[model samples]
Target: MTNRAGRTGTLNEELLRKAATLQEALPYLRRFAGEVFVIKYGGHAMGDDTLAKAFAENIVLLKQVGIHPVIVHGGGPQIGRMLERLKIHSQFVDGLRVTDRETVDIVEMVLSGSINKQIVSAIQLAGGMAIGLSGKDGALIQARKLTRSKADPDSNIERILDLGFVGEPRHINPDIFNAIDLDAVIPVIAPIGVGKNGETFNINADSAAGAIASALGAAKLIMLTDVAGVLDKDGQLLPVLTPRDVLVLRGEGVITGGMIPKIETCLDAVRNGVGAATILDGRVENVILLETFTEHGVGTMIRRDDPADGEGG
Candidate 1:
C-alpha cells in the first residue's frame, strides 16, 4: 500500500512539473503564434516510429498553440529502395542523384504520393489534421531543369550534362500554401516539382523547403537531419553561426562534403527573408519542443545574425 501511494505521488509530481513547463512556454508560443514555420523533416525521424510520433506531436502542439507548421519531407532511402526493386541502375553525378525520366517517375511515386501520404496519415493518427501535398499540386514549386558536369573527364564530363527531370526550384506559389486551413490541418509537402513544359522533376527537399519558407517569410526554418549541427575545428558543434561563420568554418575545413548544401540551404533561406534556419538532430527525442518552446535549443542554428552567446534562444 505504501509503495503504491509513493508511485502515485511521483506521478502527480511529474504532472505538476509538466503543467509548469507548459505554462512557461506560453510566452514563447504567443510570440510565434500565427507565424509560419517550415520544417524539413528527414533523417532518422522519417524511419523510426518513436521519432515519427514525437515529430508528429511537436507539429500538432505547434498547431494547437497557433503556429502554422509546414512540413517538407525527403524519402531518399525509400526512393532508392523502390528504384532497386525496379532493377534500375541509378547513377550519381556529384553528390546529387542523376534523376532521369524513369527515375523521376519513381521518385514521384515513392516520395510525393506514398511517403507524403504516410506522413500525413501518421500526423492525423496522432490527433492532428494533416493534408499531404506535392509541389505539382497547384504548381506550388515551379522549377527548371538543372544541368551539371559529370566527373569522367575522358567522356568530356565537364561539359554540361543534363540530369533529365532533376530541377531546382525557381519560384514558389504561396497562395497554394495559404489556401490550406492551417487552423487545424498541417501541410505535408513532398519535394517534386513541375516545369513550364509540364514535365515533372525531382527536387531536393532542402531546396524546396528553403524556397517555400522564403516565400512564406517563415519565422523559422528547422531542418531535421542526422547530425547535430555544423562543427568547429575542434569538432564541437557550433550552436550558433552566421553566413560569415559558415564561410569561416568552410575555410578551416570544418564544414565540407554534404554539410555544404544543407548549410547553403540555411543561408539562402535566411537571405531570402526567412527569419532563421536551424539544423537540428532528428534522432534526439523532443528536440523540436526544446528548440521552439524552451530556452536552450539542441542543435546548430544559422541566422542572419548570431545571437549573443547565452542569450536569445
Candidate 2:
C-alpha cells in the first residue's frame, strides 16, 4: 500500500510541476500576443530529426499563442554537401562561400528547393500551416552582389575579390508580409535574393533574418545557434546584454570567430527597431519556449540599453 501511495504521489508531483510551468508562461503569453517574432532557425538543430520536429512544434505553439512567427533558415552544411556530391569546387573567403555562377545555381537549389520545403513539411506535420518562400518571391528581398577585400600581409596592399553571386540584402519589401495572414500561417523563408537586373544571389541567412526583422519591426528577433547564447571568457552564458556591452565584449575579443556575425546580426536587429534580439542554443529541446515564456530565459537577450526598449522581453 505504501509503495502504491508513493507512486501516486510522484505522478501528482509531476502534474503539479507541469501546472506550475503553465502558470509561469501565462504572463508571457499575454505580453507577446499579437506580436511578430522573426526567428533565424539553423545550425545543428535543423540537421537533427528530433530537434527539427521540436522546433517546428514550438513555432506552432507560438502561433497558437497569438504570436506570429517568421522563419529564416540557413543551409550552409547542406549546400557544402551538395557541392561535394556534384564535384563542384567550393571556396570560402572570410566564411562567406565564394559562389561562382555554377555554385550559386546549386546553392539556390539546395536552399530554396530542398531545405525550404523540408521545413515547411515539418511545420505542417506538427499541425501548423506553413508556406515556403524565398527572397525572390514577391520581390521579398532585393540584394546587391558582395565583394571582399584582402590586404597583403607584407605589402599592406588591399585588392578587391568579387564573390560571384554572393549578395547582401539591399532592401526588404514589407508589403509582401502585409498581405499574409500572419495570425494563421507561418512563412518560412530561404535566404536567396534576386538582384535588380534579374540576377539570383545567395545571401547569408543570419543577415537576411536581421534585415527582415528590422523591416517588419518585429517584437523579437531570435537566432537559434549551435552554442549556448553568448559566453564569457570562463565559458558561462551571459543571460542579458546591451549594445554597449556587445561593443565592449567585441573589443575584449570575447566575441570572436563565427559568433561575431551572429552577435552583429542581433545588434543590428535591436538597433534598427526590433524590440529585442536573442541568441539561443538550438541544441536544447524547446529552447524558444524556455527563452520566451519563462522569466529566467535560456539564452542571451540583446536589447537597447534604455529601459524603455526592453518592452517585449
Candidate 3:
C-alpha cells in the first residue's frame, strides 16, 4: 500500500509541475499574441532530426497561440557537403563563401530546393502550414555585391577581395508579406537574393534574417545558433546586454570570429526597430519556449535600453 501511495504521489507531483509550467506561459502568450517573431533557424540543431522536430513543434505552438513566426534557415554545412561530393572547390573569406557563377547555381539548388522544402515538410508533418520560398520570390530581397578589403602584410596596401556572387540585402519588400495570410501559414525563407540585373546572389543567412526582421519590424528576432549565447571573457554566458555592452565586448576582443557577424546582425535588427533580439542555443529541446515563456530566459537577450533603464535580458 505504501509503495502504491508513493507512486500516486510522484504522478501527482509531475502533473503539478506541468500545470505550473502552463500557468507560467499564460502571461507570455497573452503579451505576444498577434506579434511577429522572426526566427533564424540553423546550426547543429538543423542537422539533428529530433531537434528539428522539436523546433517545428515549438513554432507551431507559437502560431496557434496567435504569434506569427517567420523562419529564415541556413544550410552551410549541407552546402559544403554537397560541394565536396561534386568536387567543387569552395572557399571562404571572413566566413563568407566565395561563390562563382557555377557555385551560385548549386547554392540556389540546395538552399531554395532541397533544404527549403525539407523544412517545409517538417513543419507540415508537425501539423503546421508552411510555404518555402527564396529571397528571389515575388521580388522579396534585392541584393548587391559584398566587397571586402584586406591590408597586404608586406606592402601595407589594402586590396579588395572579390567574393564572386556573394551579396548582402540591399532592400526588402515587406509588401510581399502583405499578400500572404501569416495567420494561416508560416513562411520559410531561403537566403538567396536576386541582383538588380536579374543576377542570382548567395546571401549569408544571418544577415538575410536580420534584414527581413528589420523590414518587418518584428517584435523579436530570435537567432538559433550552435553556441550558448554570447559569452564573457571567462566563457560564461551573459544573459542580458545592451548595444553599448556589445560594442564594449567587441572592443575587448571578447566577440570575435563567426560570433562577430551574428552579434552584428542582432544589433542591426534591434537598431532597425525590432523590439528585442535573442541569441539562443538551438540544441536544447523547446529552447524557443524556454526563452519566450519563462521569466528568466535561457539565452542572451539584447535590448535597445541600457541596463540602468531596468530593462534586462
RMSD of each: 2.4, 1.3, 1.6
lDDT of 1 by residue, 1-313 (tens): 4799889999999999999988877778878889889999998889999999889988888888899999999999999889999999898876678888788989999997889988998888888999999999999999999878656757755567777788999899888866878777799999999899889989999999999999999989999999988878787888888888888888888899999999999999888888888999999988889988876667998888645322344
Candidate 3 residue 141 C-alpha distance from true site, Å: 1.0
TM-score of each: 0.93, 0.97, 0.97
Scored by lDDT, model 1 comes in at 0.88
Q: Supply the global lDDT for candidate 3.
A: 0.92
Task: Looking at model 3, report the run of 10 residues with the lowest lDDT sum.
Answer: 304-313
What would the per-residue lDDT of candidate 3 be over residues 1-313, giving only the tens digit for each residue? 4799889999999999999998988888888899999999999999999999999999999999999999999999999999999999999888889999999999999999999999999999999999999999987989999999999999999999999999999999998899999999899999999999999999999999999999998989999999999999998999988888988999999989988888889888888989889999999999999999987888898888654431422
**Highest lDDT model number:** 2
Tell me the tens digit of each residue's lDDT in model 2 across 133-248.
99999999999998789998999999898889999999999878988888899999999999999999999999999999999999999999999989999999998899899999
lDDT of each: 0.88, 0.94, 0.92
The ten-residue window of minimal lDDT in model 2 covers: 304-313
For candidate 1, which ten residues in a row score worst on lDDT? 304-313
Off by over 4 Å in 2: 1-4, 311-313
